[model samples]
Target: MSGNSVPGQGAAPRRSPEALPPRSKLAITASRVTAAISRRAGKGSGSVIGGKLALRLAPDLLAQLSVGLQVVLISGTNGKTTTTRLVAEAMRAAGPVVSNALGANMPAGITSALAGAGDEARYGVIEVDEKYLAGVARDSDPVAIALLNLSRDQLDRAAETRMLAEKWREGLRGRDAIVVANADDPLIVWAASSSKDVLWVAAGQTWQEDSWSCPQCGGVMQRPGDDWFCSQCDFRRPSPTWSLAGDQMVDPDGRIWPLHLQLPGRANRANAVTAAAIASLFGVPVEAALERMKHVTAVAGRYDVVDYMGRKLRLLLAKNPAGWVETFSLINPPPTPVILSVNALDADGKDTSWIWDVDFTQLAGRPLFVLGQRRLDLAVRLEVAGLQFQVFETAAQAVAACPPGQIEVIANYTAFQQLRKTIKEAAQA
Candidate 1:
C-alpha cells in the first residue's frame, strides 16, 4: 500500500477494542445523561450537543475511540452525508459499521458516534466537514479517505475552495491511506493526488464555475466533456479507475454494474458510484455494494415524503450552488408544485448571495411557492430570472398554497432541519 500503514496491517494487528486506553467514565456518563435530557425535552436529536459536552470533558474522545478500527472518512462540500450512509451500509459486509448519518460532520459529531458505537464495531464511516477534514483524518488515521468534490459552501466557516484544497493537499501529502477521489472534480483531484496512494473515480461533476482556474498556476483549465486539464501548468485530471455511464458504474476490470438508488438524478448515481468505489478498496464487491445502496430510501430526509397539512411534501436539501444545480434537475418535467425554502441562519450560511449563481431560470415556467426567512431574497432572484413564484409566510401556508396534491420541497440546511423537526413533532403529537 505504498508505505501507507492502513488498518488491516501492523505486527500485532491491533484491531481489538482493548488496544486503546480507557475513556473517562464520567465524561461518557455525562454525555448520555445530556442526550437523554435533550430527547425528553425534544430539543432536536441532541447527538451534537451531547457529543460536544462529552468531548469538552475528555478532549481526545474521538482519537481514543477510533484506535482499533479501520476508519473510512468522507469529506466534501456536498454529498458527504448521503455518501457516508451508503458506504457505511456497504461496510456492514465486513462487520459492524458505525456512522454519523445525521449530517453532523464535525469532530463533536464523530465523538458522539464513537460514544454510541458498540465495542464489537470493527469499522467506522465518518462524514467530515471540509475545514475539519485534516484534523479528523490525522486523529483517526483513516484506512480510506473519499475526497468528494469541493466548492464554496458556508463561506463564513469554510476556507476558500483553493485554500481548502491546499489544506487537503497538506493533510494527505504523506499519508498512506488509499484515497478514493472524484477525478472529475479538478479541486478534489488537486487536493488528493499527492497522497501516497490514490484511486480515482470519475463520478461526474455538474458545477464547473468553481474550478475554472488551475490550482498549480494562475491559468485557465480546459473543459473537454467531463475531462479537465490546465493550459499553463501540468495539472490535470487523473484517469479514473472507476467511471460512470448514465446511471451505471463501469469498473476498471471491464465490468459494468447498474445502479438503482431510490434517490433520483445523476448526482446521486455518482454518489453511489463513489461509495461503491471506496467499498471496493476495502474488499467489498461492487455488486454487493450496489445491491445494498439500492435499498437506501433516504438520508437525513433528503428524499423522504411527509404528510403535512393535507399535502404530501417530499423533501430535498441543497445548501449551495453546486447542490442546487443537481437538485434542480430533479424538478424538471415539472411535478404538482414546488416549495423553495431558504434561511440565513448560521447553519445555512448567513450570506445568501450564492443563490444568484444558481440557475433559477430553469424554473421559468414552473410554479414555485417560496417560504422561510429568506423568501424575499429568493423572490427577488426569481423575479429577476422571470420565474413566477408565490411567497408565503410559513411552511404551513406554503404547503396549503400548493395545488391539493403531492408537493416537492427543496430547502437549504436550516430550512430542511426545521421542516424535519416540525414533521417529527407532528408525528409524535
Candidate 2:
C-alpha cells in the first residue's frame, strides 16, 4: 500500500461482532450485508466491516468512487474529529454531506463512510487519521483539506508528528487540493507550505506572545503585540485571515447566548478556531459559522456531558498525549474533581511511555480519581508527578467513589468506551 492508501482497502467490513460469514463468500456477503445494514441503519449506504474486515476489502472499489467525490479531509494530532464535524456541518448548511462521524479515518473506514454518501452527493467530509491521510489522499483527491495542529500522538503504528507531516508533504504533492493550515503550529505550517491555496489561520494575538519564539532561529519572533511576527529572521508567522481572538471573545451577535463548549480544555479553543476557519473557507460566512459554533454540542465520548441524578458528568476521550494535555488544560484546581482512566491496547498504543511526555504537573493541585485496566501504572505516574489521586481497579468502583455533581472523567479510547457503557447501564438500572 502507498503511505496514503488503506491496505486491503475494501473487503474488511463483512465479518462483524453480530455474525460471521464464510471467508470465500466474504465479498458477496459483505455486499449484501452492507446494503441491508445501511438501509436498516438509515445511514445512507452499506455498512462495511468495522476494522479488520475493512482491511480485507478490494481497493478497486475505492478507485471507482474517487473520480466523483468532493472530499474534505481533516487531519491533525488533535481536534480533527471535532473540527471535521464542525466543518462538515457548515458545508451541509450549503448542501448535503457524507462523512465518517464516528471517528473512523482509515481506508476501510473512509470507504464505509463514503458508502452512504450516495452516488449523487456533491460533498464528502472525512476526519482522516494522520497516518492514513497520505493513503487516502492518493486514493481520493479531496477538494479541500484542513491540517490542524500536530502534537505527540500514537507512537506505535504512526511515526512521530514531524515524520507524519513529511509523509503528508510527499503524499499530497501535486494533488490539486486546497489546503487550510494552523499557522501557529510550526510543524503544520511547514507541511502546508508544499500545498497550494493555504489559508493560514492564527489562534490569536495575545495567545502567541509567549509561545511564538522561532524554533528555527532561537530568536524572539516579531510581534505586532496583537498577532505574531518575526522581524529578525526570514521565518515569520502568517496573519491569519480568521481569528478566535482569545478566551475573552464575545458572541458576534448577542451576550445571552452562552458559548456552549462541549469539549473540555482551554486548548480546545484552538480546535474551535481551526473548525471556524475551515468553515469560513468552505463558504460559510464567518458570523454565521461562529453563531453555529455557539450551539455546538459534543460528539459522544469526546467530552460529552451527562447528568447523574443530580451530579454532572463530563466524559472526555483522551487517546494520546495531545488529548491528555488538552484535557488537563481544562482542569481547574482546588475544587473540581477529575477521574482519569488509561488503557493499554495496541490500537491505543501499547507503550505507556507517552504518559511521561504528558503535562502531569498540571494536576498538582487538582483532586483526581484514577481508574482503567492500567490504573496502577497511571497512579504511580501521578504520584511520582506529586499529584494526589484515588485509584480504582474498575470504572464502576471509580464512579461509585466520585462525589455527586460536576465530575469530569478523563479517559483513553477503551477506558472511555467501558466507562460510558458502565455509566449507561447504571443509569438504566
List where candidate 1 sits over 4 angstroms from the true fold. Answer: 3-23
- Tens digits of per-residue lDDT for model 2 on 215-267? 44556666564545455677666656555545633322323222345555456
Candidate 2 has its poorest 10 consecutive residues by lDDT at: 1-10
- Write candidate 1's Cα lDDT for 1-429 as tens digits: 652224454522324434444555566667888988998997876788888998888887788778777889999988999999999988888678889988888898788878787777878899998889999998888889999999988767667899999999998889868988999989998899789898889888899888999998969999987778999989998988888999778997979888888988898899898898888777788888888889999998899988877568889999999999999888645646888999999888898899999998877666799988999999999999987889998887777767766787899999998888877777777
Q: How close is candidate 1 to the true structure, as a TM-score?
A: 0.95
